[model samples]
Target: MNNPDSLTNHFLIAMPNLADENFARSVTLICEHSEEGCMGIVINRLTDLHLCDIFDQLGITPDKASHANDVVYLGGPVQSNRGFVLHEPLGKWESTLSVTDRFGVSTSRDILEAIAENRGPEKFIVALGYAGWGVGQLEREITENSWLSGPANQDIIFNLPLEQRWKAAAQLVGVDLTTLSSEAGHA
Candidate 1:
């Protein structure tokens, strides 16, 4: 059985051998983990799209101060067209999943509207889609050495430059991924 409490509010750093193109070199923020399943957003994969593109498509006039030019992220492979906003200073939003005292994920238009008007959370990252795992799936992956997870650090998620988040998240567990060998070792 998977330990439901073990993964919530953690960062899942993809192992070097995890060759899936979608997740390679990815750093995922595990927002929820339960017997039911797991869900997360890839914190480091910037897509070609920008926040302004999303706002324009949705007919929301983004505030100039809202960092509308920031690159949008490819959160994960699931529900690629949906938007998930990870933000700090968690507050009430139309549809939000409070991940921790300092972070939350919002999936509602109202929050987007608030952001467009510069009334949303102090810091936010807009992403499309999310990574999901069925019951026991993530635990199995961990046991297989497919990922290295540790407590999520807001600095990596909210402050680090996009190109550095993957390495920084791995370093949270004292790992320097560059030094890791792709093949599993036999003791």
Candidate 2:
């Protein structure tokens, strides 16, 4: 059995051969991983929606016009209407999963309200939905070479542009995915 703790707070960069339409070339941040399963958010898939659109839908008036155009990501394939706020300088919220000392994922409307009111964390990426794996499912996929994981970095999550994040995350483990063969090699 794989150590569940090792998967938490890491980035799961999909292998080039990952044929799943939902996860091709995706970068996912594993927020929690345990015997029960694993949960993560795809950080680089931007949707057509904006922060302002979400705020309007939630009936919260956005306080920062500068942030109105911020992209809202399609976190994963589950709960597409649900919001997940991945942020830093972790703070107490109505419902939050503390991913690390410096990072967290909040699934509460309160956090959304705080962001709209300009009282949220210093750095954050708002996503809708999240990726999930059933018990042993992720481990099996990893063994099949479906992913490459490395310690998650805040800079890549919040600073890098969406298009660069996939490659950047892969590079964390010294992998230039472009140079990798999609076919698995046999010795």
Candidate 3:
């Protein structure tokens, strides 16, 4: 059994052989875990949309004085229409969920408003949708060697350029993603 506290605020880095499209070379942050399986976000996939576009659709105006470009990310497969923000620690919103000491997840418009006003967390990546697992599903994957869990790094999660995050996260476990083999072997 994984220690409840230990899995909290950790990254589940997919192994070289993970074949699932949703998780191949993916870096998932375990946010909320309970008897109800696990829920997290893929921190590295960037979407074509921008944060400002989302705000515009919601009729929220970003602060003109702030450098108001919000980084949009591909959160996961579930609830793709909803927005989730994985951000650096800062001004807390009522719905902010602390993933770790350095990161948190907020799904509230109030937090979005703060972000638009430049009064939100210092660093943030806005994601659409979220990845979810059924009870024991994640554990089954881990047992099958589909992932290698590691401590979450804020630099990789919040600070690194999106293009470099996947490689950087894979490097945390000393594996070069380019050299990885997607085929599962049974020798």
RMSD of candidate 2 to the truth, in angstroms, is: 2.0
Clashes of 1: 0
Per-residue error (Å), model 2, residue 10: 0.6
Better of 1 and 3 by lDDT: 1
Cα lDDT tens digits for candidate 1, 1-187 = 5465668899999998999999999999999998789999999998899988999999999877886888899999999999999999888888999888778999999988888888988889999999999999998999899999999999888898989998998988999999999878878
- Which candidate should be chosen as best, given lDDT against the real structure? 2
Q: What's the TM for model 3?
A: 0.87
User: Which ranges of candidate 3 are over 4 A from the true structure?
Assistant: 1-6, 178-187
lDDT of all predictions:
0.91, 0.92, 0.80
Q: Give the per-residue Cα lDDT of candidate 3 at 124.
A: 80
Q: What is the lDDT of residue 142 in candidate 2?
A: 95
Best first by lDDT, ranked: 2, 1, 3
- Provide the clashing-pair count of each candidate structure: 0, 0, 0
- Kindly list the per-residue Cα lDDT of model 3 for residues 3-120, writing each as its tens digit: 6544667788878677788777778888877777889999977788887888888888889865357568888999989999888774568788877666789999998888788887
State the displacement of the C-alpha of residue 66, model 1, in Å, after optimal TM-score superposition.
3.1
